[model samples]
Target: MCGKGVNGFMKRIYMDHAATTPTDNEVVKAMEPYFTQKYGNPNSIHSFGQEARDAVEEARKKVAHLIGANPSEIIFTGGGTESDNFAIKGIAWANQKKGNHIITSKIEHHAVLHSCQFLEKHGFRVTYLPVDKYGLIDPDNVKKAITDQTILVTIMHANNEIGAIEPIKEIGKVVKEAGIYFHTDSVQTVGHIPIDVNDLGVDMLSMSGHKLYGPNGVGVLYLRKGTRIDSLIGGGSQEKNRRAGTENVAGIVGMGKAAELAEKRLVQGEEDKLIKLRDRLIKEITEKVDHVLLNGHPKKRLPGNVNLCFEFIEGESMLLNLDMEGVAASSGSACTSGSLEPSHVLLAIGLPPEIAHGSLRLTLGKDNTEEEVECVIDILPKIIEKLRALSPFKGSWEGLKK
Candidate 1:
């Protein structure tokens, strides 16, 4: 039983790990000392400053180790959004002499899509490639999209909304054969899955701390050695002049600890446990519920992602009911939560607007237990039945069926 609601009858179960995760206790402990005891400017020339600088460098090594990259390749930034902006804009600006074209999938997070859109508004040309019904981008499509003018290929390693893991290695090989720079917005897959820059054949990768149970404002942009990219900011010579401004020392420390823990957990078989819970949740829900459509690739998905669209009911109404029952979930990305529009990812994958509007995403986490999954599975069907009973759309659909 997670947390009790106001009525004390329902337990608050958080199933929105994809949106953001609670900071691990060890991460908080790692960050606490940096906040007060080691509070010194890493750039300053003093003993205190050197201590902070050493901490930052150590954190960088940890982050690099997690991704199987050199410490020099990791550039700390404000967060995933900034890292994405840096990768897209930096590559474009620095490689204008090579080309002015970028390639990306239509179902990427807004960080990637909006960054590409921003470049499109400028002189650069961006090809928004289409995804299959499972939100998987074909490597053949990527090979076809390439041209002499294509400077960079930025695709996400995993889909945040639908949990479709892209064939990045295959795409990377295609891009590599063409001698084009490749980047991946791996904010969702960094800690959840094993990633090696060399194995993926990616030149740059973006990652967020919060997505992996670390501090919110810390992130890493893995820029491979000799990858030509301009700085997103212009001030101090931080992050090897790739990203400017004073570093978030405490946040970086927390992120490093989080990365270490994540790697350890993966080695100890955390993925298997999460996958079991995720599959159980999906199985129970689909078996008990009717008119439900599963999203994303069946097997090639994140370990804990369960995206489903219930017919004849609005997702927001379902979410509200779930919240009352003490279950926290998301219809889509938290970045686009307030928008009335259906999820772009769902729409891209061929879901009609009505079905897209009914999408529900339940992402499990490390702390989630089988009991929580059972509770959600037990109560969710009742909630859906209640919503369908009250929905005029469902009533009309039933009449049509009769």
Candidate 2:
């Protein structure tokens, strides 16, 4: 409940929970013992090692329960990027004999997109599907794009920039009927939405720990039983030889704890509260601001996401102004380099460069309160007004009037 006070003039509020969240205190507490007193390699056969091994398994079960998957299906990795790589590259390489074609969307995170690009460089064929204006991928497109040579279809459950929730169940049904493997990068949706791997019919799913108020450097790749995928990192026999490396004991433990907490919150219906807060923020912003447009599906977005595009101002400038005001949010994906190219995801949805450049993403989290939402609403309009006034395009508006 503790957060920065609203200074009205200077107090900053954090609305960018989608980008990343601070590790919860309870998760941190669960991880503290593993980092120091109980630290032991799980691979060791000694009593100390057995204790660590027990914790890892217990954590594994928690992560599995969060997504309605069996404990055996969970494989820990260095985070969402690694899990994505394993799902895309690992599956493509292992199933190369079956076919070399892969299907994914243009709105995917760089992790999945770049992995597909890497496969293409090595002679694999990949089809980048386009999304609707709401950023939702059409399952029919997947069906149309599939061929006898199609080996895998990788799509994200929810977009990071605009929070567009894809129709995973429908997409999964098509992929299943086609007998092609379906991989979903659920980094943004796993903790925010209800995810049942069996119901999703996904052969593989990827999730990042930090997105769920857990420690960073930990991720889970849920490979359905009997799914075929090669090991990306080959070394010692760990993760049943599917992923080889020393287990990130503390991070895994924290991720498991966070996932368990997220499940509990879901059961208690905290989602309704989050959705209300998000909608309120969106309503207030759009009502007060001129030339602003909501950028994603109105009803099909994450409960905590509110993405908008304001005309004339640039995203980086808005982000900087918000940061200076103590409000922490992101203009777009954190993975993009310093190119400032106005988010490929935004452009993929058919947004013009000027509007896309003015995008702002406000993602809520468990720790955010209603007061914080009000504070952001009160402060954001003034900032946008100031930025638009200074923009070079503002002069163009005057010329048009003349």
Candidate 3:
């Protein structure tokens, strides 16, 4: 059993790792000194400041190592949203004379999607590519969408809601062959999957620290050498003048430690463990629940992701039921949870509105155990049954059975 909270509530089992992870103790420890003892602005000329600056550079190197990027290429930002904005808007603004068009999928995180929308409002044209039933954007569609005016193609490496891994390498190949910049919002993929910037042929990638067991308020944007991008924030010279702001020293340090730890775990076969647990959870749930469909690609998905849609129930109800039982998960992206609309990602993948409304995402993580998986499996079916009993679509399932 986990430790009780200050309110004497038993700790809930967290299955929402994709939404955001708790900062690892190791990463917190690595950042503690920066808060007080080593607290100095990296921009200052004093030795105290130089010590902080050195720590920031070391963190940058660690982040670069995890993604096979050079340290100089990594620009630290506020978080994934800021990184996405910088990658899209920064590139779009800098290259506006060359082209005023961009390409992206309908299933991207709000950060990228909203940035593209903002660009469209600014007189730039954007093509929102449609994904297939598996939430995959075809390379052929991407090829056809590229026009002379197309400056960039921004797609996410992984769908935050459905756990669908896009064919980024193939998409990158298309963009590279067309001589256009390819930017991927890799917030969900960076620490969870094997990512090498060169191997993927991506010109830019966005990553968030909180998504990978690091501190929030820190993110990294990997801009391939020679990529042209304007600075988002104009202030003190930091992040090579590409992202101008005072350095987030402690958050950057935590992110670097998190990246290093994730890299080491990847080498130690962490994927295999997560995959096994993920598969087991899916198998048990599917076996116990009727009229349920697994979303996303069966094989080509994140190792820790398991998204499903159960017939005849609303996702919010299921979530509330699960939460009452001390299990924590999410119906869709954490950013969009308060909205009444069904997940845009689920809709993009061709799920009917009713089915999309019933979606649930359960992402496993390093700290998750088999016992937790078993507990979820045991409790989930009962929750589903109760929800279905109260659902208006209950008749639909029965009618389908007949």
Which ranges in model 3 have alpha carbons more than 4 Å from their true place? 1-11, 333-336, 395-402
Which TM-score value belongs to model 3? 0.95
lDDT string, candidate 2, 206-290, tens digits? 9999999999999999999998889899999999999999899999999999999999999888789999999999999999998
TM-score for every candidate vs. truth?
0.96, 0.95, 0.95
Residue 250's lDDT within candidate 1 is 97
Question: In model 1, where do residues sit more than 4 Å from their true spots?
Answer: 1-10, 333-336, 395-402
List of clashing residue pairs for candidate 3 = none
Off by over 4 Å in 2: 1-11, 333-337, 395-402
| C-alpha lDDT of candidate 2 relative to the true structure | 0.90
| Preferred candidate (lDDT higher): 1 or 2 | 1
